[model samples]
Target: MKPFSVAYTSACHFGVIAAVHLPDDPAPVPDGVLGQLPEVERDHARTLGGYRQVSFVGGRLALHRAIRGLGRRAGPVLPGEGGQPQLPEGVAASISHKRTLAVALAARDTHGSVGVDLEDLGPARMGIADRVLVASERALVDQLPAQRQWTAVLLRFSLKEAIYKALYPYVNRYVGFEEAEVTPLRDCQADVALHLKEGEGPFLVEARYQWMDGHVMSTVRIRSGTPAPE
Candidate 1:
């Protein structure tokens, strides 16, 4: 297999986004690439079948590149609870991928956990809107022009996925789609409102997104341990 290459890299509010393009053929990843990863990651990749292994390896490659961009040596990104990336101390990171591309976001853990997600700009599938959006969000989508509704739903979906990733490390639980609402603003930014059940309160979260090679890339940062407002 040909070596994977860095597609692009950009700075986001939370950290840096690194995207890598996977090989066109679905052939197994080359030993050279696999050899570069930590033994644990290599073993885990071995267990995954077909394109899954490809995605896993590509995501780690992108992550290592992102870490290097931060002037840090890349460490083993083991799978933590829920298979999230177990980043090195003082680092926060997230990974997402499509068939041909993998993206990662990495930042210093000074502020909080960070998450990143990538989604293709395909037409929305039927009934996906109902599944992803809360009532109010659905109402907002309904007001958009017909052609833009799909993008609207997808933008919120991508943002919510990033939001969940950023918050899950702190909450240590499954946060439902309804648990948070995203109101997208201009300039590829959005505001998130968390409605966690009593006792899950007090996380400061923010999100941003951009278009990359016909895909929607979203990211979020979450700060925990703060007291709820009086």
Candidate 2:
């Protein structure tokens, strides 16, 4: 079967996810991306690099693949709380992978930052939304058409994750899901507005989302200097 492929491009940002149904047993490293990992990362390379598993290896590859399109030599991929990847010195990045897909997002900002996440818009067996989505978000998403509700919830989470990743470096504090609110979809993007009642006050963040081949991918860009293309 021909594997599924999804591509997204914005300004200097590019992301791609190739389908992988193979077992996550450390498949042989691909010809191009193996840059001999440090002893720490090598121990779990097989498990991490293989599909279906989420580990440092998967994170590194997602980070690398996302940045590859920009012709960058981003040093090593750094890790943060919750296993999120730290962008290179000046780049803003966020990554997410599920089952057989991996997605990365990056942006160089003058003021604000950017984040991107992709998720499988399938069943809710994980009950992940309970921990992440606020009451309001669930209320709205649950009302979406049966065929679209799954995508709506998936995009909401994906967009929020991207926003959190983009804001982490500057704010240096955890942003709750409730503080972030996603407006109805406009064009291919969604307007993200936030009201941080606990740590900070209200602010605005803009995000975009798209559904492709049963997967929902979203990107949030919050820049201070100037905005980039969607």
Candidate 3:
């Protein structure tokens, strides 16, 4: 109930979910991160790298609050597969990020778990889909009104990444854009559907995408162990 910042949250078979926004600050040239950043990323950082450390702080704090809040009722935090943070023993958890938010979810009776994400919308990049967007996705994104296509592209890209992070620890399977298709629901307030293709993938993934405050934020949550509700 804390004014816990969030990009997304949901009740699960486990406990509760918390998502924090990773504030964008001018990033300092940290020894390791700078070296690891791609050439292009490095170039961008060069312009205003002085305050880029808040990327996940908001999400981290929000997660802690969620854990604390859940602990008040469920217990403490536990670590999950790949050293991911989870609820105390006998609990399951998942974390996700998009642009400036990180979300964490937990429950006592879920296997697949929960995840959330946030994405910032900006000017259209030249041919992003050529590399990240799948063929069909590219076609769909391109089909949007010229003015709206970029938002749609960013929306899909952000949601897909969140879905990947949400299910990665449990499924441990590589998910490309083709594996997950996103369809936005229509309404003043709508949610995005993270449709896992027919195969060995997350059976049901739920997500929400919103264009607010001049940025596109998206959240993805997947429930595990429980069979997909028809």
Candidate 4:
């Protein structure tokens, strides 16, 4: 059997998302999997242990699958500045993993920088509502049904994380949770407004999220040369 099974693969507005479900056993990342990675990545994986290694391997596998779906041969996705995946030229991608699942979102560079994040929908995250939501966002959540408030908060939080990942390669700076506001729209879409300082003014970014196996998968694509409305 394959070391991991494909949980899902779907086309998105930005590109494609591939999710891989890893085996429960974290050690010994299955035969031949390491060979699939570039020498650099294999060497790097050697430095990791336990679940970290599993996550790294699973992420790379998912990424390769995603790039292939985009009609490109996958290359070494080395870690660039800040450990972001340095995808092959003309490709934009992001990776996120939680426990046994790794998810990747990839697109042609023409789609601009892209990011994906996977967050577990668990009660433990319920208490983070105040920490992640801005005042206006909190007000929005307050209007939700009591049972849905935490889900709303988590959705916004996940989208903001994706927004950060999508924008960081350009801004190359820390973007706090409060720096971006996410207004969730219907049909699994959301709008992002960046509150960067004067010079960091504009970025044309779009955000979306979907529920998968009790986790929220969020993605954002920032189109180059397009500016966000004032």
Candidate 5:
């Protein structure tokens, strides 16, 4: 069997599973796989173009595979609080797509919650970094060499997204980029502290990233308390 790009790390109690799919030569996804998506997903699919459709399906497929690998049966993957993929009870997961590439991560509820994101490496978007980075984050970016700063900025962006996804069920509200501070550590790993506007937080999530096939893929796993009531 051909291999999928997957990374695994122990987070919380159980394991965090991150899987990546590069559809440069994707195999066909079964129609039955599409059938497993909830109505919201079906409607969302209708709005996707050809490339997105393929990546969406591929993401769903990768998600299913991840779930099954966790020893659970594959079932409907729905959108829940904050539009994140709602996993089966006792499961927490996240999915992200960039152009033709999609990535997903999952862990049993016992493992806490997980969020994954993928971003293609490229020249800096003119105003994006400033808009997304908080004062300290921007200052840190300035400390890096000119050429490598954008990649760091993009990595922070991806980690912020991963944090939002990981905590939305707990926070149950929109989290902006400025709410969290991301510090990239060594070994392609990073840490985030969520400074939510209200509620009991300053939640912490850890992230791991990889650079592959010209893309930066990041995954955040939170395994402290259980997910917030939904």
Candidate 6:
């Protein structure tokens, strides 16, 4: 089968953002290549279901290639305290999997942090929107056609997830849903503002998303010292 896709972006001046999509069944990793992952990763793979294992390894494989493409070597990407992948020094990456689709995004140290998330598009469940959306966002959704509200909710949720993944390492804590908001822009893009509960941050993350083979993919790139958008 043809490989899914790989693309680069200049959204972050400090480093290029590269994304990879694994569409078909993930290619098997040889022992040598699999060995490149840290023991935590290998051990974690064993704990996942068969399909989850494929995605887990596929994500690591994609990250290896992404980092290598930057002309640098990233040693075994390990799992941190929360099972988030820990990139080698001077690098940051995020991975998301949806069914057969696995996407990974990577950036160099200068870029600060990178995060990407993929979610299958579907209608929002009752009460979900209220739980995830802030006041202004909910008002915007209310103005849209009833049928369209679910999509808006899903988009906001996905953006928040991407933001959370990007900031968790720095925050060292879980960011709440009510604490962040996403405002849509044209061409499948959005701006996210996060109000860190612990007063550590009021950071901003710029996001762009696309529909790929039935999934919504959102990517976030945060440059070091990037201030909140006015």
lDDT of candidates 1 onward, in order: 0.86, 0.60, 0.55, 0.84, 0.70, 0.71
What order do candidates take by TM-score, descending? 1, 4, 6, 5, 2, 3
TM-score of 5: 0.79
TM-score of each: 0.93, 0.71, 0.61, 0.92, 0.79, 0.80
Write down the worst ten-residue block by lDDT for model 1: 1-10
Model 1 pairs whose backbones collide: none
In Å, residue 1's CA in model 6 sits off its true spot by 3.8
- For residues 12-73, could you state the per-residue lDDT of candidate 3 as single tens digits? 33357666545444345454443333354345444553333343333344555565556544
Candidate 2, residues 1-230: lDDT per residue as tens digits?
A: 21222333344323332222222444555533344444444444545434433334455555555565456657666466755565666666676666665566655544356776777767754366676677888888777777776666667777888788776665778888887877656687677777666555333467777777877777776654323447
- lDDT over C-alpha atoms for residue 132 of model 2: 63
Q: What's the count of clashing pairs in each model shown?
A: 0, 4, 26, 0, 0, 0
The weakest ten consecutive residues by lDDT in model 2 span: 14-23
- Where does candidate 5 clash, by residue pair? none
Q: lDDT of model 6 at residue 147?
A: 83
Colliding residue pairs in candidate 2: 111-224, 112-223, 112-224, 189-208
Candidate 5 lDDT tens digits, 1-230: 12233333233222444454445644444455556565666566656666666677667656766676677754667666567776778887788877555666767766568888888897567379987899998998999898888898899998888877888777778888988889888878886766777855535476888787778878787755434667
Which candidate comes out best when scored by lDDT? 1
Off by over 4 Å in 2: 1-55, 125-132, 201-204, 224-230
**Lowest summed-lDDT stretch of 10 residues in model 4?**
194-203
From the highest lDDT down, the ranking of the candidates is 1, 4, 6, 5, 2, 3
Clash-forming residue pairs, model 6: none
lDDT of 4 at 218: 94
Worst 10 residues of 5 by lDDT: 1-10
Cα lDDT of candidate 6 equals: 0.71
